[model samples]
Target: MDPLPFLLQPPVFYPIIPYACTIFGGLRPGRMILIQGSAGISATRFQIDFQCGCSTRPRSDIAFHFNPRFSSSDAHVICNTLRKDHWLDELKFSGAPLKKGETFVLLFLFLPDKVKVSIGGHHFLDFTYRLPLKDVDAVGLYGDVTIKELSFLSSNPLKSGSADLQKTPLSKTFPMGLSECQVIAVRGLVTANPDELTLQLKSSDSIPFKLTANFQDQTLSYNSFISQSWGQPQNVQTPFFLFYPERFFEILLLPEAGLFKLAINGTPVNDYRPLVFDLKSIEELQITGSAGLFVVQC
Candidate 1:
């Protein structure tokens, strides 16, 4: 039930058929692709492909091929791979939910070992990797479909190396303290029916930034604790409820000039000015909540 990452990339709206685009940063675990479109009224078939490249003469290898075919008698979904212009063993599933002239939301969540496919907010199937996921660099859509929007959501903010994957109620200290350019990225899944999730940047005697996700109220609030007491809380109602129960989320905190910028998923959510001025004094990061932590990178 993780919410789809929206507005991460410049959405491709109403693109011409047979669309193909390079996936920036390539495919990785925890990344998701969301597509919103409708099938053509007279359409017989359509396909979504994750390809190694965009080559056509030799036909670039397809890591995952998700095709839905609508026949007079049978309507099913076929998943397979294409390598060296040859099709691999096909895996077919019955009862494809897609219908002609109906708008649908398609989500592909990339995990470590398999790709989870969801259509119209419902779980469909999991496609195991026949080809390595690291090789997928592009995505394509072909045949009778009209795409309203296509978006890519990245859970990790670190670009060069692996991040520390850990559990929640985590408390880590930094001897060198924080810097102006530091970015702390936290990715996790909220527990079912979570009450509250808190993330704090703390110093020896003060907390410069503390972010709280109030599930019951569906609000994101922030405040600072400098004089042994909390400041007036600033809350923002997230209409989309980014941190729903049992939903995956990614939060990024970047230290700017005089404020800290917070982004959920890939969208910038808020900027909070801190009561404490010294960035170096912020030596600890603490997270306590009802969520499973995946990646924590500073």
Candidate 2:
């Protein structure tokens, strides 16, 4: 038998928090979800849950409960599964990645054994499965959050034990390819007068490739920390990065032998030496500020 085809669902635009949206056909063994939003200035804690239903009085079972608490010095993310009428042992991760007043990209990649949570584009951590995914009929959000976008789309089969990056012809991998550049592309909207958009590739807690787009000063920088101390920042002029709010754009990055070439739309943009030579260690990609996420393809 063949794998299930990718399913595309209409995204929910800017919605009020404490929201719950139904999963059209529940969920499959392999499903991908994108939640785009920012932490409110007064946000100290927030919770996102994948539950069997939206019942209240007689609380329904929750497949995955993601709670991020920033009220204490030791901020942590608590993950748990609610079965029957009791909650399971909580998995708490210290050092929360979310800023109280900054925008973030939360990507949830569901696999057979775990649900991979990527903050921005970089991998955050993985939560082992406790409840059957097929029972998850709703995605709910509550607490101090300003949701910008929330949607689901299925495409490409994931390789076992990692985020899926199908190695095929560029044409087949990306439909919007201008000239068959087998690189990573990010298409999204921009905010006004932003600082920078950063993407970090990390293994465990170590970052290999750190790509930063500075909009306030019109500069692009690349830095790496494959070992211990951070490397010197490689900066270049990118006056084209400045833009008004909600403008559509695409950024393409091709990692050649020694250099990583970047482009805006179809035009050339910038280039820098790749700090990360070992590709397998980069498990996460982090994208923050300056831009909204359309897609992150590797």
Best by lDDT: 1
lDDT of each: 0.81, 0.68
Question: How displaced is residue 75 in candidate 2, in Å?
Answer: 3.2
Model 2, backbone clash pairs (residues 3+ apart or across chains), number: 8
Q: How well does each candidate superpose onto the true structure, as a TM-score? A: 0.65, 0.53
lDDT (10s digit) by residue, model 2, range 18-88: 89989888877667787778888777889899999999768889999999888645457899999987999
Model 2, residue pairs in steric clash = 6-154, 121-285, 121-286, 121-287, 122-284, 122-285, 122-286, 123-284
Predict model 2's lDDT versus the native: 0.68
> Which residue ranges in model 1 land beyond 4 Å of their true spot?
1-21, 27-46, 53-63, 70-75, 80-135, 141-165, 236-239
RMSD (CA, angstroms), candidate 1: 7.6
lDDT of 1 by residue, 1-298 (tens): 2223312343455679899999876898988887888989888999999999999998999999999998877568999999889999999998878888888888889999999988876889999999999999999999999997676756421211325335678987889988886878777767767999999999989998999988887888989998899899998435466675645577888898899988786667768887777888888999998887766778
The worst-scoring run of ten residues by lDDT in candidate 2 lies at 166-175
